[model samples]
Target: MRFLLIEDHEDLGRSVQERLMLEGHAVDLAQTLAQAREFQQAAVYDLVLLDIMLPDGDGRVFLTSQREAGNTTPVIVMTARAAISDRVGTLDMGADDYITKPFDYAELEARCRAILRRRGGVADTRHRHADLTFDPLAGTIEVNGETRELRSRELRLLEVFLGAPGRILSKDHLCDRLFSFSEPVSDNAIEVYVGRLRKKLAGSRLRIDTMRGLGYRLSGT
Candidate 1:
């Protein structure tokens, strides 16, 4: 899953971003409203972690604007405001969930998974493509009941491909999905990951096809 975390606090933002990445989800951290909006426009995120107190503006206003724009992307607001009214206000502004500051990472992860399940963003922890089964939480892949070990990057790339089988994915978009803003990634790097993934799927019905000057597509034989 791809997540956009809108947070300004350096320590908090970095911690959350790193934690999410370690959990096998691609995360993009935006420190300000402007940066968040730009990232939102560029990518389609499965969920958003929004901080209400931002440097430029209030997070509630931003959530309201996004809702008004018909952006139904699930949003979970994180704020220090623990008052009942504050919670109600955020929910009224279209936030799907609220987490108070100083909360545990475990709690946050649980809420995120629960919300995603409710929104149908992730029907389950396991995903299927042809005969291949992928468990994002366990970071494991199984084929015909046999387990296959894959590198972290390989798993991430395969997850993206399985999400949209038969769809063409551009190099730029794949780069965006695979790496975060802080990581330096090139087209050659993407090709390297794809090459590694291709070798792993050798006996599977799934195939990743390269479209020169276009991109790559994952299809079944």
Candidate 2:
């Protein structure tokens, strides 16, 4: 999944970015609201980790703007505020979840996964399509009863496919979801990932179909 992290604190921002990156997700870090807006305009994020206090303004302002503009990207507000009102107020502003500062990485990651699982409308990280079983939390995919680990990008690609099953996904949309803004990408990056995934899905009933000039779709062959 791709993420937009809006934070001003240097150490915390880097720490969180590194942690999320290590987990095989692409993340873009913005230290100010302006940069955050720029990143938002440039890329589509599956999730946004927002900080309450920013250099330009409070995080609530950004969240309010996103909701008013009909941007439904999930947001998780990170705040150091201890007051219950502050926590409740963020939720009222359309935050999907919130984590208090001074939090452990494990707890924060858990919250992120929980939100994503809910966003994908799946009860858990485990999903199966015919004989192909995917458990992202476990970092393993079972194809025709054979289990193996896939690369990070491959796993992420499966996550997107699993979320929408047979829906057509455009290359532009796939590119946005699969890479960070800073990552250098080739014109055929999505195709490369799709090709790799196709090889992995061999012997399974599912296949990725390329629609001419449209996009790609995961469907049973």
Candidate 3:
């Protein structure tokens, strides 16, 4: 999953980014509210880890703006303040969850996953169809109970398929979703990953159908 970490502290932001990366998540770090706003406008994210105190502006303002814009991206407010009123205010302002400052990195990761899982409407990380099983967190594919790990890019492609099963996804859209603003990924690269995934799931009922000019789909029928 993709995440946006909005923090002003350089050290804390870097640490959180590294930890989330180790957990198999793609994260973008924004050290200021301006940077965060820019990133939010350009890219889509599964979750946003926001620090309530910013050098430029209050994180609460950013949250309010996002909500006003009808952005439903789940946000977890992180703050040094532990006052009851602050917590209540953040929640009332539309935060999906909250974490206090000097927090544990593990707890932050867990909270992010919990929010995403709830929003995904699936309690488990596994998404299954027919005989094919996909674990987004582990980046593993199981066919007939035989499991194999996937490369990062291939796993990302599989994620898109699992999330929108039976629906066609254009290669262009897939490229935009799987890659970040910094990386340059091509159409052939996407095809390569898709080809690799097909071989990995060769024995399963899962099939990625190519619709010529349209793109690809995980065909159920």
Best by lDDT: 2
Please write out the lDDT profile of model 3 over residues 108-214, one tens digit for every residue: 98898788779988878898778888887777888887999988767877777877878989987776666655456665977888899889878888889888999
Cα error of candidate 1 at position 152, Å: 3.7
Each candidate: RMSD: 2.2, 2.3, 2.5
**Model 1, 77: alpha-carbon shift in Å?**
0.7
Across 1-221, the per-residue lDDT of candidate 1 in tens digits comes to: 78999999999999999988877678899999999989877888989999998999999999999999999999999999899999998999899999999999999998987887788667688877788877756667787788887877888798788768889999998888887777666659989999998988877789899999989999993
lDDT, candidate 3, residue 183?
54
**What TM-score does each of the candidates earn?**
0.88, 0.87, 0.85
Candidate 2 lDDT trough over 10 residues, lowest sum: 120-129
Q: Looking at candidate 3, what is the lDDT of residue 106?
A: 86
* Candidate 2 Cα deviation (angstroms), residue 131: 2.6
**Full ranking by TM-score:** 1, 2, 3
Candidate 2 accuracy as lDDT:
0.89
How should the candidates be ordered by lDDT, best one leading? 2, 1, 3
